[model samples]
Target chain A: MPNAFSRIEDLETTVVILSELAAAHEAEKALLARVACCRYSDAATFAIKLALEEGMNNAIKHGNKFDADKTVELVYDISEDRAIITITDQGCGFNPSAVPDPTVDENLEKPTGRGVMLMHAYMDEVAYNATGNQVRMVKRNT
Target chain B: MESSGDLVLDVRQQGSAIIVRLVGAVGMTEATLLGRQLDELVQQPGAVVVLDIEHLDFICSSGLGALINAQAKARPYEGQVRLARPCPLVMRLLETTRLTNLFDVYASVDEAVAG
Candidate 1:
């Protein structure tokens, strides 16, 4: 599984704003799918799609706590070698370190934390903003 | 082909076991509903829950969480959750999450229900 994402230069970025409604998830997925279809293989597309779903879900369900008044900020970008997705929620952030390891024996059956694990597994880089309300993931073309 | 927005969970009972046929995509949005359905079925004493994913095209980690939660909840009732015939994408997800070893997976629902 890949770990942290570092700042990089040279990119094509697009900004998107979505409501806190669950309906916004489909739009996010569709945008990701379009990017995947243009630049990635079938396997890569699946991984990216899964990562996007997990990240957006965390933002909507966990970060924003399903508060309809809030909004989700998404910055979608693609470089020559990788795709960068940054999602931010307008709620009190959480510490990613506090999340339990889902792979461990005691946590295997637990429902939580698996989404974060999958995001790390599929994306080459996963990073959180200081407050933890924002997550930036990068998937390498390779 | 089932679209991502459409998630159809068809549940049926055979003997003491319950079979859930999952179709389309199971993402975070649909996870709560799916979890609730699983919760209702697993509440029965000694219920064997079999998830038939032959038609399931996609499932996120949140969706996987629902399944694991059901498995945990059913354990106290002498019940178990089994997965049957997951598509390639779903199988890869299970492997990535290291959940493949946690549940008894069968090639078909019949084998899962029989066990």
Candidate 2:
């Protein structure tokens, strides 16, 4: 509960819903454009973009299991100093702690375990709901 | 701005090396595409693959994983995967993941192909 996020109350929020991977991609790119327009540095924008991609991919692929019947919800608010994004899927949730660290020797070559790690690494704060179905991430401008 | 989640891969053969130039943002869908293409290329005899990322706009975790997986696939055959001119964002990602040192990166494709 830092004051930085409390400032989120002042900014407008946008919500996007999608059931397909192609749609999710477009939504993510639009979100990134908004983030960049807020004047965040190149690195900060890239970090947010990466986190958003991973978050959306997880919601669509892992959570929904690529079921077209299920939909993913993305809510985001960006200000001059920070960006906050939350993604929720209609499928059963997962335990975030169960993800294996991709940096380890044995897991380093694996291709699928790095999404959660990248989200945590790029975003200033990454939090999962009690049921593990929803994730909220925050990135601040430095 | 228009957003297309398209990840384009342009492959060409230079001597014994296979050059794959990636363009646009890379996500889960594109990762699979890249992985499949790399699998085919790695099977070739003496496949020295060079990934050119100069035109790549963005790359997610799975995209990074695809690159590493491709590199791993080439190693057993005495072939290798080299990275050329990764943008600042991709470079930062590789550095953060601690996988930057695992691959040989060159300034350009000519340098990588020659090396």
Docking class of 1: medium
lDDT tens digits, residues B72-99, model 1?
Answer: 8898888888999988878888888789
Model 2, B1-115: lDDT tens digits are 1233477788898887889888887877687888788887887666899989998878888878777887888877878888899887788788778787678888899999998
Candidate 1 local lDDT, A1-142, one digit each (tens): 1323335433435544454535657556656666755678667777778888888888888988878688787777665467888888897999999999999888888778988988988888999999999999988887
Instruction: Report interface Cα RMSD per prediction.
Output: 1.4, 1.3
Q: For each candidate, what is the lDDT?
A: 0.80, 0.83
What are the per-residue Cα lDDT tens digits for candidate 2 across A74-137? 8888878888899999878999898888887777787766889999999999999998889999
**Model 1: residue A84 alpha-carbon error in angstroms:** 1.5
**10 residues in a row with least lDDT, candidate 2 chain B:** B1-10
TM-score versus the correct structure, for each prediction: 0.85, 0.88
